[model samples]
Target: MSHHSIEARDLAFSYPDGTVALDGVSFEITHGESVAIVGANGAGKSTLLMHLNGFLTPLRGSVRVGDVPVIKSTLSDIRKAIGTVFQDPDDQLFMPSVYEDVAFGPMNLGLPLEEVDARVIEALTQVDALRLKDRPPYRLSGGEKRAVAIATVLAMRPNALILDEPSSNLDPRARRRLIGLLGTFTHTKIIATHDLDLAMDLCERTIVMSGGTISADGRTGDIFTDDALLDSCGLERPLSMQNCPKCGRSD
Candidate 1:
């Protein structure tokens, strides 16, 4: 069987007030690939990520998830196949309890009660949030809420995971723990983040966006090493690169 993954071609979008968010952006991620979308604020990274799951329709192009175009007919299935975790945990953790929040996706998919229960348990266990399953989402720490938000999507067993600014507002320990958890997922991952360290730790490929356009796309190592390109995109070299013995560069 031929397995196609996420593909976007000539995508363009604009805000209600005529602010262009994405312009002629195109990229393809193979199945199981981990890619990072890096850009400064208002660089259109979030808008592009939204396209992957059909949350926002493109004004002048197309997007496909596993050969299914992101149209109204395929929106539900597409969303199921490509799960998204918002930058803010509160945006996704709306259900009263962690268990309910985690179960929401599978339940909405019309799975049987037993299957939903199993999925809830499995997802929570994967994120190490099983102990907090009964607790209200608001009561948990920021990291805990982030984990539970991820669990909500995992319960659906999506083929691809999309996360926006996932490392924002996390302490060092919590951030490291999240990196470890995300490392274990075999599914394709597309993380849009300003956290270059997280990008270096997780993604093999890096895509750089600027002014609603793709300015660079290549191996993570090369992209991070190109100081001029990073500078152009309002990014800096990954700390690991800067502190490398071989590169011999410092602040």
Candidate 2:
């Protein structure tokens, strides 16, 4: 088995309108590592996550999850290994009931019915949404809906968890809960978000994206301390008053 969980080599993509999203981006995420991709709006963060799961094919180069390449012939297999959660919960959760939404991926994978049921229950429990399993997805609060969306992907037990703006639109309490839940998972985690506070708390490493390419990749503490670099990327330095649990050091 390969040591790297995800590898992108000289990847590039352009939209139908000739707008470039990713420009020869290359990086590798190691197994069991927690990484945050930080960038301003339209920095190609979401575009990169799409390539990780084969949702968007690169106009050039390639993306690989473990030993499997994210090509058309292997897209399904690659998706099974990497569960991607979009920034908006509504984009991911469309089923009527929470249970059904969480069960969708497992069912699509053709797991046995009983196994799927068990996975659904486990996933809901993971996100502390077991009590809302039968509730209508539309009725849940923003935080609740986001939890369900995460549960939907977790039910498949993907090898790597790729979350885009996982803490977006969440209240402080909800954000704390989400972070706690993420801390329990041991899989390789890649999160793309502008929430530098959350990234400092959760990720050991941070990759800075700008103009469709990675501008910096290093320890989270090192990246956050550089004011000039943060300014260049249109990101503010993480507040000096905040405490980061992962580093066991507070500013």
Candidate 3:
């Protein structure tokens, strides 16, 4: 599915105040690939993702979702192919009930009521959240909100998923649940997160960004094992890869 692949060419962007967020960054993510974008707080991980679905336009360079350019004229169609789940579930879930929130996207697409209903059921079922369909978003536990937020995106049936900090703010069980949920998606996934363990679990490939540019891009294991490299990027080995307190640090 070449049409589902994403590519960025020489991407460069600067904020209004003249802060360079990305500088000549470029990469390609093939269809069905789950890729992790990792970096420090201001490393430009978020900025790079914003350009994928036309949430932000590049000052110089181009991004293409398959054959479609991520430009103003193609935004509507592009959005239909890419569903983004923001870091905060509250940002995506605003309807009174879980059902409405899941149905919102397909409904906006002018789908028939029957089709929308089918989609909501399928999405909620996928997340194993059918039981919470009637609950208010605000009333949900952090994990519940995360599941529903993802369901809202799944309901749209996009070929790719863009998640910004999908594991953020969740308790251990909630985070593990989120990881399991995401592991089941066949769609192309581009996740921006500080959750190195999640990256290790879900992605085969990883891109490390620094100062608005990529410092490393390779298999997740190779990238994560390089202590000096990760340390330079303001990160450390994931807990799973670390030595135990009595074992001392592993090489």
Candidate 4:
């Protein structure tokens, strides 16, 4: 892969139970772009993210990260370029301590101990979780775990970051902090979420999916403002775009 740009071309997938997850979904995300995929439950947002990182392969189409295609033989290379942070922090953090969890990726790659230690410290510092290094991940609060989970991915030094429902189960302050943390990164980010407000805050481009296909792809502001489009796909205007109930003002 090169520059970490992502591309999905005419992709299609079906679950083992014969439920269709994606059908003819296609989009190209350029390097360093922040893109959001938003839709209702069962709209296939998570499935698509999984395909990008090779966690699930498309039955019919293909995905490319930069120039590298996501195939079984290149799975390692693909994963190395694309770091995925799943919807649940618990699914990610399992090591005894935050430091060990963050160091796991680099260690698995057989890097020198010095390199692994440096990477662990760097990743933790980036997520503002260095102070939590020696603590057990299971003992952390929701926000701390979220930060540490992100630190785990950052340690891999992936070119593009894929996150699913990253703001779920967080308090307002924690959500705000997550947003600020994500904004500081220069790498490409593709976020799948129900949180339109977070999408508006982080993504410049938004893709709307419905029935396992892309219904719309455009500017985040344009997509959020289109009430009919959102309604058709079971979405609502972001809170920032909606008029306030108290004073009838829109952000």
**Which candidate comes out best when scored by TM-score?**
4
**Model 2 regions more than 4 Å off:** 1-4, 240-251
Error of 4 at 164 (Å): 0.6
TM-score of 4: 0.98
Measured by lDDT, the strongest candidate is 3
lDDT of each: 0.92, 0.90, 0.94, 0.93
Tens digit of per-residue lDDT, candidate 2, span 28-67: 8989999999999999999999888888989999988788
Which parts of model 1 have CA positions greater than 4 angstroms off? 1-4, 244-251
Lowest lDDT 10-residue stretch of candidate 4: 1-10
Better of 1 and 2 by TM-score: 1
Model with the higher lDDT, candidate 2 or 3: 3
Q: Candidate 1, 242: how far from true, in Å? A: 1.3
Clashes of each: 0, 0, 0, 0
**Candidate 2 Cα deviation (angstroms), residue 125:** 1.0
lDDT of 1 by residue, 167-201 (tens): 99999999999999999999899999999999999
TM-scores of the candidates in the order shown: 0.96, 0.93, 0.97, 0.98
lDDT tens readout by residue for model 3, 1-251: 24788999999999999999999999999999999999999999999989998989999999999998899999999999999999989988999999999999999999999999999999999999999999999999989999999999999999999999999999999999889889999999999999999999999999999999999999999999999999999999888899877868664
| Residue 130, model 3, lDDT | 98
Error of 3 at 175 (Å): 0.8
Model 3 misplaced regions, further than 4 Å = 249-251
